[model samples]
Target: MAIAASTSSPVRMKRRSSAHYRLRRRVRKGALGVLILLVLAYTLFPYYWAIVSSTKQGAELYTTAFLPALNFSYYRQLFDNPVFMGSLLNSVFVATGTTVVSLALGIVSAYALGRLDFPQKRVVLMAILMISIFPQVAVLSGMFELINALGLYNRPSALIVTYLLSTVPFTTWILTTFIREFPRELEEAALIDGCSHFRILTRILLPLMGPSLASTGILAFILAWNEFLFALTFMLTDENKTVPVAIGLIGGTTRYEYPFGQIMAASVTVTLPLIIVVLIFQRRIVAGLTAGAVKG
Candidate 1:
């Protein structure tokens, strides 16, 4: 009887230890879930408030309402304004042009840097990196002088040219990393099939580069779309203004009244397109960024 009691005592202790571990794990998981919820709420609350504020009318803007009024008169007014509509168009054109040009130049530059052996290759890459790290203000004066000298000031082309300075370097750096991770065997296989360098790049590599391109292109588009400093400086007229500049210039009914509603409405209008793009390309963006993380 004594031996049996001792054995049963050990079994009870083992059961208690197992239950304690499970309880601790459950508490830990619950805490982690709560932390994630708080983080998400903090990050998304501002955008939600903006969206809610945009729908409010007149004195309603001053309220602390959590839900939107669902009134869209502010949006209607914004769309009716020709200057605002034109700025939206201008932003689209400039952003799209910058994305295409940057990607084109970056892809070729990346291919050379990644796949080929050349003298001063590392030096060239370092220079590109340095250019990317330079702030817009640091280059503003020189860029303005170049634009004025080329008679491109106040032109859409000026913004595109200046934007390329920032976007191209980023695209080149990212694409170079991605291209380097590609198997050399693919290029060699194409070579044996009598494929020219250009052919190999266009046919063999480009299809595989879709994910990277989508990721980089969307980022470049966002940068150009939201750029205000260059746009404000270079685009002098209402006719050439981008969305950022246009939104800033939105006026109140009188000197005493601020157009908070209109401003919030414009903000929502401009932000939605970017959010949609991100959602659409989210998968590609994830795949591109995580391409070389795992070996197998």
Candidate 2:
């Protein structure tokens, strides 16, 4: 029985290593290709539908058409509306403000934490990380009260300040890690050449840190741009809405269904800048992340 079992196992193993096994492998490859296509369809169908839908006018929308209409009426209406355009400008202002402020504060803080050794530095870093992970909802009331107290209620600046709660910590954390990987010897060499610490960071480090900075900045911009809760809560007036809040302001048909054509057109419009920005700076993002505070 033992001899028979040993011989049978070898036969099975040989079968697995044979042309039959190759056929199974091909079958799996074909199955995987089909599965990938299905997933691609599932993921992309919405965008495709949006494109198709955006081309139709409100009247033409009741009857579904798989083929896109060349009508630009929805787009014209969107651009012609002052409220929508104002909201778009407001989003640009808030998002830009947040990015600038966060990066300004983050680089200095990150440099100190990353390079300058101090007492309880690790503790401080851990605290920053912990704060970054905290639920935004937990501090919603507190932030709202503070904004009101600061007399910034219903202002674009209020959103700018509040967004820091989300953007700054993460920015600092990433920048710190990247900075820490810098060569200590370079700083030493700069110091010996009578360069100030600030000069070293500005002239030597900042240029080298471009890719990471661009990546971090883009991420910050996206966060601020897409932020809905704070935009909705703070921007009370019709004139003060951002893209996300502005989209909600436009009502749907039958009080339940959204104006799909307009909404999708706005979506398409809003997403183009992000896609362009990312495509332009994507290469730098990878380089910056990998250019850590380490040297060979």
Candidate 3:
């Protein structure tokens, strides 16, 4: 009876330990789920509120309400305004141009930086990093002078050139990371096949880099699309203005009055494209960002 009791005591302790671990795991999962929900709500609530606020009209806009009246008249008004429509086109053109030019240059720069050995390579990369770290306001005056000197002021081309300052560095940095992780064997194989450097980059490396390119391209587009300081400073004319500047120019009946409804409408209109782009490339973005995190 003494031996049986001692053996049973150990069995009971083992069962209790197993149960405790299971309970702890369940609690941890529950807490993690709650945290995720809170994070999602925090991140997405502002966008949801924007959508709700956009539907409110006139006096309704000032009223506190979670659900909007589902009105879309402001969107119609936005479409009717030629200046606003023109700004949309201008933003698209500038953003697209910036992305294309930045990526085109970034890929070559990244290839050189990541794959080749050269003198002062580290210094060059450090310079690019420092340039990216500089705030837009810090360089605004010099950029303005450069734009003016180049005859690009008041033109979409100005925004493209200035945007390359930010976009190219970012793309190059990200692509460099991806290129560094790429197997060197493939490049050597291509070289042995009598392929030129350009041919190898285009035919071999470029295709394998779709995820990184899409991620960086979309980010560059968004940055250029939403840029306000440069857009406001460089593009003075309404016809040349981007969406951000045009939205700020939305007016009311009186000089002191602000059109909240129309402002929200324009905000929603301009933001939808970015949201769609993000959704479309969500997978690629995740893959690009996580590519070099693990090794076989």
Model 1, 1-296: lDDT tens digits are 99999999999999999999999999999999999999999998988998999999988999998999999999999999999999999999999999999999999999999999989999999999999999999999999999999999999989999999999999999899889899999999999999988898899888999899999999999999999999999998999999999999999979988898899999999999899989989999888777667776
Global lDDT of each model? 0.94, 0.89, 0.93
Give the poorly placed runs of model 2, Cα more than 4 Å off.
1-39, 58-65, 253-257, 293-296
Q: How does candidate 1 score on lDDT?
A: 0.94
Residue 188 lDDT (model 2): 98
Q: Residue 41 deviation, candidate 1, in Å?
A: 1.0
> Over the stretch 136-197, how does candidate 3's per-residue lDDT look in tens digits?
99999999999999999899989999999999999999999999999999989989989988
Worst 10 residues of 3 by lDDT: 287-296
Candidate 3 overall lDDT versus native: 0.93
Record all residue pairs in model 3 with backbone atoms less than 3 Å apart, i.e. clashing: none
Candidate rank order under lDDT: 1, 3, 2
- Alpha-carbon deviation at 31 in model 1, angstroms: 1.5
Error of 2 at 197 (Å): 2.2
